[model samples]
Target: MPVRHTDPPPAPSRAPSSVPETPARTRSQKVADSPSLMAIVAIAAVGVLLYTVFLFDFGHRGDWPAYLLVVVAESFIVVQALISLWTILSSGHDPRDYTFNEAQRALYGNQVEQTMAIGIGMRHAEMQLNDFPITVDVFITTYGEALADIRKTVEAAVAMDGAHTTYVLDDGKSAAVRDLARELGAEYVAREGNAHAKAGNVNHALSITTGDLFVILDADFVARPDFLHETVPFFADPTVAFVQTPQTYGNLRGLISRGAGYMQTVFYKFTQPGKNRFNAAFCVGTNVVFRRTAVMEIGGIWQESKSEDVWTSMKLHERGWRSIFIGTELAVGHTPETIETYTKQQLRWATGGFEILFRANPMGRGRALTLDQRLQYFGTATFYLVGIAPGLLLLVPPLQIYFGIAPISQDVPGLTWFFYYAGFYFMQIVVALFTIGSFRWETLLLATASFPIYVKAFANALLRRDQAWSVTGQKGVRNSPFTFIVPQVLAFVFLLATSVVGVWQAQLDRAFSLAVFWNILNTLVLGAFVVTALKESREIARASRELRALRRAGREPVGEHDEKVVTPVLPEPREERRAVAIKPVTPVPPPRPAIAATQAVAAVPRRHRAVAVRGPAPRPATRPTPLPPLRPAAPRPPAPVLPSQSGPPSISGPLPGLPIGGGPGRARRSAGGPRAAEEPEPRTAPVPVVPSPRRRSASGADLAAEVLSFSGDSFSGDAPARRRDRRSR
Candidate 1:
């Protein structure tokens, strides 16, 4: 019998930085060779050829049924190809150019500038290494994490290059960490209350330690030998507050983990450098050095908030201190080795980020924060909201498959769609290529697959009444379908059912056949996702079991020793220097007030005061008093009478109230003539005066009449009795 050979177990996935060397594709070579473009061309060619064949066959057989099916298939392929092409084209960025030397140089320079400002500053301070030999306190925070992981980190901290004392603040209360700490000659600080989770643990450490500087590390991370050598000197600067180092991962044993590491590199090595360039690099909750004075000044590490690092940093910045981001990845940490943990971590981050946006925007709070600080704070908090975009995009294709409802109309001719959609598709490819490169494609696809889940998680977090921090379970294990399986299964079932219904409909009518193909394709894609999810689920379960067993065995904990390390205590307020004040000089007398020049002005006021006049002083007569005016002088010779028409003399009595022109029975006036006058009769009419209501005499009545006659309108020359009669009427 022939010997049978079995395949060896797969090697654990290595970190991207550590991937075994493949033949390197040079920049020029990659640009010249385009596999994506070739695939697109091939797809387009097949589509056109199939359409041509269908067109000819339709002409020959006159069997529109077969021809229609071919046309539909051909159309779908062409449209899909064109869409892909268009996306690649419209992305506007050239992936090939992104990897070019010049682009790399720019990105490198940005990173250097960022790292230099923060990392160099810290390192330079460290170089001034004080032989003060102060005892420093180290806090390693753990939550539902495996003992082995905790042990690795604690052991690494113990090996730190300084006279440092370590403390393991285990929220899980695992004896493993306590024992490991004991073995490593470090202190194990366990807390009964885990109210704020990691923050609570760290604060507990703070209460017990008397160190001048606190080095905080997450349980999953191990410190480097030079961690203290590179960071401690930064505290020498009285103004230098806290120092933060980039988080780096070592082994990436899976595709997800590898992708996450790559993202971190780009973020820390590239984006972080840029941020640091502007003094905006923020803390990542681990590998941070805090000044004891500054921490205490702001009430120590904040435990009330979900994200303690951000909350504490905000307070520190508000209190007029500085933070630095050391570009060097000085400490080694672990990525989520499986997809479930990876997703869980991302979800928790997203939820926490949203919490900050809703609750912690410091803009309107009237704090004395710089514009740069505000932007940095807001940018850090709102970064996770970007996940909503991909979540929305995922729903689009699924909806298109399930219902024949396209978000955009697909009724355009095949050729029109070919160029338009192909260009759009090409644009996206370009953008992806430029931004993430090929290494991240799988991660992007997985992210796409989990988009809906992420969206739901975010929405649920928002709606839930209680906002509590739930640490992602990082122990590598595979479990049953209960965690991530049920959703996948349900999605698969729905997708499968839709596909079957689509195929049945296709058989009945050729027009609906395209719908059937679309549904079937959706089903296949969903099925792929379901398989991947199950695999990840199993891995998580296995890791969980391993972690539980390690806990039961009770391995030694890191940071278990009780030795106390003394650090430089900050100076008391009385010992601090105070500003000196100078004595005030005596003032000279002010200039004397100026005196007025004239007493003559004062004499004028005295004269005016002495000349008070009585009311109504007698009026002065101008020389001659006028005699009574002569009478009207004989009516001034009767004014000439104008000629009148002779027909019944036009009955001209006071001209009735007619205008100067004549109508049927009226006389007309000519423009040139002047004439008709009447004489004034008397100054006053004879008075038939009755006795006044007040019983006054006739002389008084006469005086009243004289006054009335002098007044116009009422009685200019008439009797007072007539005026009185008119008033009565």
Candidate 2:
């Protein structure tokens, strides 16, 4: 949750009402984060230095081919480590300083309100620039995403607490989406063709909508109510071209989603903040705010490449426009939850990096980037190349297994090699722990499994062609995840065979081989990814089978999407159900003189007459959970006496109707004068039944039914009215 923050300004300032503010880093957090970051850099620097020393030692060289491969891969790894450490060292910068905060405070003034009716009669706070109201267009770019997801994003975009127009740019030409936009009161944008894919969709919106500053949110990214307040203030700096927030996600339910999210978590939390110091923070196609003039100056958003975001940002940077990347999560959406989506996403991003590295190098001629920007962009270009190293490194064990060849000279003891290896790789894990908070094994698995994607992206860039893929994963008919991870399966099989041979060789020699162990571990790592894909494949097949069954039975109609995609789920255990079945519950106090609540165990309040939450029905084989003994209700408070009353009012049937066992009747101030003041008409009370020997335990619903069905003859009442009131209650 966001907190309220107020800082005394040097001069007094006026604002319209109040706004929720992002939490500011406390002095303790600043103190703790700095030391932790430096520690990581220090430890990582020493490890890389020692590993480089061990690698370059001439005496450790073995076979030329294997040795050269090892050196090249390790060199790239070392370069990546150096860049990461440098970035971590510069992670102390916060783009949102006093200026940004002050600008945010003055974003809405009380002098003149700027209101636009959006989203079913919703209006927002004034969006001001220099205390003058400014126009902002919030664009949600969609291309074949689910309509429900798009609706959520559009609703949020319109409801944002700022005077802005929300538009849904539907590149899929979806009529349903257009209707949804109309129903939501958001403008609908459709184009004749998706010439440049997402970039074209946005550019088309740019042509007609004339907002001074525009925000771009992906179809699934839902902006927060204060998103405009957060990013719009950064543009107060005239030179700032855009404000980019991290692409945070809320749907981390699938393994693929978790792995893909973890892969970028560090970049958003640590690297982007560090990049902001160099004014090299780039837009990521979503959750970004761009100045219209800066974008117009760079022509429309660059549409030649798949990654128009980085390409456009490069053009803006070359044009000498500054960019800001805030580390805050202003909007959240879903990350790729399937192998096909993950592969396509990674491929596109990597291709963009390589294209920038080659076609229009930031470090090359005809550019106006500073030294800091040059180094940061160069790092970005080479980041994906580091992914290629893992694929090459996986082959080292096989080299030793197939032929008696090794990267390290036999003269070097195994222990020395292990120590040097640990210094680099083990220390990297420690660095991840410090920087990313906790080390995630899923990240490692995804990283290792995704090398083929990077390799394919590089190949596509090298060939100057697109990696055309018409995957069918998101309609009624779905493709198996295995279709996308063929390389991983082949690699796993080869490594497994190599490990088997290595194991046999070790057995024949009556000795242990580190190569066999390493090969086996790598094989298992790959196997885990294959297993994940297999699980997804099974889910897709199961969904297809169920859809077919539904169609055959004529119980459901055909549709473009199978809403019931069988996600991987585990069943609840029997113990939880038993516990829930035996749990106790009591009603909260009512506004009456007779039935006051008791402080019994597990007495749930009746805010809405809560149905005690319980798990599924328990099994007969499981141990019977005996219900706890019921406690007696507390005595009702004595009715207050009115000074006008002559004597104590005559009592009627015991308290109009206890919820348990007491018969139905209304208690009164006098026998027939009038009912108690502020009292509602009487209803049938409940019955409390002691458990029979045959009963194991009782569920809340069963007990509540018994309590409401009480027909006890203890008190006098009209039988028909009592039964009718009981049924209704």
Q: Pick the candidate with the highest TM-score.
A: 2
The TM-score that candidate 1 achieves is 0.52
RMSD of 1: 39.3
* TM-score per model over all chains: 0.52, 0.72
Instruction: Evaluate all candidate structures by whole-model CA lDDT and list the values in order.
Output: 0.49, 0.66
Clashes of 2: 4
For model 2, give the RMSD to the true fold: 25.1
Residues 501-605, model 1: lDDT tens digits: 666666776555444564566566657666766677677678777767877889633333233222111111111121111333322211112212232123222
Cα lDDT of model 2 by residue, 1-729, tens digit: 111111111111224433556656743236336776687678879999998999999899988778888998888889888887787677677788787888787877652232222222113454666554456778888766777778888888877766677777765656577667767767666555456677766765554444568899988877777778788988777678899988777777777888888888667777777887788888888999997766755556777678789888988888777899876667878778888888888898899889888888878977788998888888888899888888988988889888878999999998999899998998888877766666778878888889999999888888788654222122234678888888999999999989889989999999878888988989999999998998898888898888789988987753423222121111111121212212244431222223323421123212111111111221122111221111123332332221111112231222221111111122222111112232233333533445343232667654444433353322223435655764565
Looking at model 1, residue 611 earns an lDDT score of 9
Off by over 4 Å in 1: 1-135, 362-369, 401-404, 409-438, 464-478, 495-526, 536-729
For every candidate structure, what is the RMSD over all alpha carbons to the true structure, in angstroms?
Answer: 39.3, 25.1
Candidate 1: 10-residue stretch with minimal lDDT: 610-619
Where is model 2 poorest over a 10-residue stretch in terms of lDDT? 1-10
